[model samples]
Target chain A: MEEISFASQLLQYTITGITIGSIYAMVAIGFNVIYNVTEAINFAQGEFVMLGGLVMVLFRVTLNIPVVISFPLTIMVVTVVGVLLDRLVIRPIRKPSVLSMIIATIGAAFFIKGAAMFIWGKDPFDLPPFTGRNPINFLGAVILPQSLWVVGFLVAVVITLTLFFDRTILGKALRACAVNPNASSLVGINVQYMILVSFAMSAAIGAVGGIVITPISLMEYDRGAMLAVKGFAACVLGGMGSFYGAVMGGLIIGLIESLGAGLISSGYKDAFALLVLLFVLFLKPSGLFGSAEISKIRKF
Target chain B: MKLPAAREALPSGRTCGECAHCSSSSGIRFETGRDLPVKKSKNSLHLIGFGLGLLLLPWLAGHVELLGHYMDVMVFVGIYSILTISLCLLMGYAGQISLGHASFFGIGAYVSGVMTTRYGVNPWLCIPIGMGVCAIVAFVVGAPSLKLRGHYLAMATLAFCIIVTIVFNENVELTGGPDGLAFIPGLSVMGHPLDSIAKYYYLVWGFVLVTLLLSLNIIRSRIGRAMRSIHGSELAASTMGVNVSKYKIVVFVYSAALASVGGSLYAHYLNFLSPASFDLFVSIKLLIMIILGGMHSLWGAVVGAVLITFLNYEWLHYFEEAEGMIYGLIILVIMIFLPGGLVSIPGKVRSLWAK
Candidate 1:
């Protein structure tokens, strides 16, 4: 085997890391939006991403629809599922404990996974790249055009979300709900409806992630769990509910995983990420950018 | 605000002397107000009835050809019962969830399998070693994770499980990787190896009964009351000098030890060890069992184990492709309509009838 230059290998891995990192960041963002408002981690967040990819596959590949039309449609469909999830599953519980709510979300995740299996079958589906299947050479490393699309979409989504949360009245309401739902309600904010909107927005973000990444990484029914776990790790690493923290965490995780696979054994690639997660959890329960409130147990 | 205020309304750190429902010194209260002697006798009767049912099970399986097919599944139920009961102790009593229990189970299996297969260690010795390793790992993991409240434990355990599974798959020389380790020696007592299904059945259930008895005793003890207190309110429990964090980690370690025992038995019974058997799905299935049986009751764990074992072995064979769908639907339906689980169904029905 010919020895590849260390610098070139580093560059290649960095590019690969960035591409996958964006996907993780997108998923983490989704988690942050919902968690910010509801304090509930939607375990089904990855299923929205899976639904995005699979729905796009249905529209574009099976039904012969154009990519331009199918992509937005996919996001819309998953957003509706997210709304229905909140309406049918989350809202109906009379007075739910944290454990009960967690179980409910887990159940929802399983339901979506099963539905995906029934709809798309067991086999993984692939989507054609938005552009020609040619690798673009850049500084001794090769990058796919599809990778650019993934990074581009991620950047656009994050910017849009940042703007939405910072400048919009609706986003302000959602932020208020996160800070103190009671106070938000006292101030005439519809906390419950805001929660529903957060779920919708989160789902839409997850869908965009799924659609773009599907061209590079194939979509399968069982892929939701792994994606969710990775995204969750990113969320935890960056600091749950911190937008900048999630992105940084995602990139770091991706880089560590990529470099670990390159330097160490590829077989233990997933373990490296998990090890980092455990280390982060043990040393800093609140995460790098998370609020101290998350670490402290509320006194009755 | 209403919910938080309602939770705070419950009286904290009250002793049995103050509460009329608790007549015993152990602080656990049975809802019934019957006299001590009568309740004790009734409990003895129930115990005897349960014992008789257990003794009758294997005999009936031996006699009835139809039940012979389920003999293997019965052994699995016995193994899962131990796992579920331990989880019941943690989740139901202590109010902590572990999504990575299968890692403890896997460790137990791998340790036992490796010891028996490669090192020529006694199966009995291997079981204890597995339990010890599980306890140590659980202690190390739980110490940090359990300090944080709520879903942190779940996330930590889930990550732990994934890491363990990856190790199992990667360590091909030791675990046989994805193909798994086969030719594991069956468990033996003295000079006799447990080769037959009936023999294994008795052995497995013997362990199950012991586990159940131990759990029942714990639940009836002061320690159990401490656990209940923790579940009710960790703050209150700590305020009452219950050592909430210590109890949480101890229960977690205890549960992992039980899962290790189950894993050892599972390896010996099948005479094979596989990473696939102890994956995330197995952990989820164990959770499902407890949830389906009713997380609040010990008996619920047993019922859940047996019910899910039956479903996996018999019912799901017809619709293999729809397995995930069925499991998902079951969880959703149960959480929606019957969150209290199958064990609570009788109570639910009686209340409905009264209304």
Candidate 2:
């Protein structure tokens, strides 16, 4: 094996960290979307990403479909899955408590993971890079095209979501519902509709993350739980429900993990992210951007 | 079954209400001062019958063709029953869920496995050492996580569990990595080693009975009522002078210690230790067992553990690929249709009959 320069190694780790961090950011965003409206963490959020990658593989590799066509198709399928989860598992409970809802989502997560395994088997599947496998050299370091794609997709998602939430009527309605569901309902916004939309939007985001990250890290059935944990750590660190915080948290966690893997023992890479999460949760439960008063008022 | 009728009389949905039969709406409240003797005598009778059944089980298994191969499985049922029962006390009674409970179990197994196999320490001594480690770990973990409300404990414990599992896999010099530690010594009574499956079964179930007794006593104590009060409403519990945080942490530590004991038994009985045995799935499986059997009831824990163990060992063996799907399906179906769990089946049947 050829030894690489320290500068190149440092740059390489930073790029890898940012790319992975963006994926965590996407997962945190999905968590925020669902949590903002429903106040329940969709534990199946990672499964949506897994489904996205696996389904993308089925469409792109097996069917020989173009990336443009398969991308939307994968998102749509995962969105349908999200809708089914809300309808079948969540809606049936007439009165839901925080504990029960958590249990229900966990059950749904397990079910989705199991179903994915049955469908795709135990093997990890890979997707071709959006462009090609060619590495771009910059500042004495090599970067994969897929990493750029992942980072670019995250930026696009943030912009689109900002516009949708800020300027669009539907997005404003969702924000209103999130603020006060009963009052929003009285004011002519359908809270149920907002709930459904949040699930759908979050699932789509998860799918996009899965699609972009699959080439860099192979997608497998069991990987969802670990990803979900890392993403959740990001959410808690950045302040749950804050989009800006989620992005920041995701990037920080990603960088720490990448640098830890590169410089420290690689075996404990996942632990570094989790330890940060625990420390953040212990020291400051409200997170970096979340308000303690607001958290106190919220039920779960 | 009679107790569930009283449970049904409570006005609240999931929260145990202060019904007429009992002043305190405790989780799995079986006997009250009003009808203490009848309920107490009946419980004692059931206990005697269960003890007899357990004693005869191995003998029956040896004689009956259909039950011949189930002796080993029954030992696992006993070990898992201890785990589920401890979780029931924490989750059902105290109303705190620890999603990373398998970590304590892993600690117990690894400590015992390492001490006996590598250092040649006595297996019995290792059990308490493992419990001590678990207690300290649980205190540190619970002190921070339990201070917050909602799913923080669940998430924190889960992270802790994952880190522990990773440590078990990566620290090859100590844990033997993914290959795990083998050739663990078995438990011995006086000088005689518990080598036979039947002997191991008896030893495991003996521990289960003691655990069940201890848990039952805790439930009936004043501390138990305080725990139930906290479960009903944390704010209300505090106003009632219950040191809510203290109780939660104490219960968390107690449950962790019990889990360690269970893990130690598992290691000694199986004579091996593997990281996979104490991974995330095992933790979830323990949760599923408690939920399936009936979270609130001790009998429910035992029933859930036995039934799930049977399914894993006997029934689900044929459907290996569908195992995860089936476990998930069971959780969904049970939570949706019968959240009260299998222990509620008799009450449901009685209600239907009355209707």
RMSD, one per candidate, in order: 3.4, 4.1
TM-score for chain A in each prediction: 0.96, 0.97
Evaluated on the second chain alone, the candidates' TM-scores are 0.89, 0.89
Q: Which residue runs does candidate 2 get wrong by more than 4 Å?
A: A1-4, B1-39
Say which candidate scores most in DockQ. 1
Off by over 4 Å in 1: A1-4, A293-300, B1-44, B353-355
What are the per-residue Cα lDDT tens digits for candidate 2 across B1-355?
2243233223323222234335334455443321121234455676788889999988899899889798889999999999999999898878897788888989988989998999999999999999999999999988998987666667888899999999999999998999988999999989998889989988899999999888877865666766766666777667767799999999999999999999999999998888999998999998899989987787889999999999988999798888888898888888888888897788778767978
Q: Which candidate leads the pack in lDDT?
A: 2
Interface RMSD of 1: 2.4
lDDT of 1 by residue, A21-99 (tens): 8988899899999988988888888898898899989998999899888888888999999999899888887767777
Provide the lowest-lDDT 10-residue window in model 1 chain A.
Answer: A291-300
Candidate 1, B279-306: lDDT as tens digits: 9888888888989998877888999999
Each candidate's fnat, in order? 0.58, 0.54
- Model 2's i-RMS, to one decimal, reads 2.7
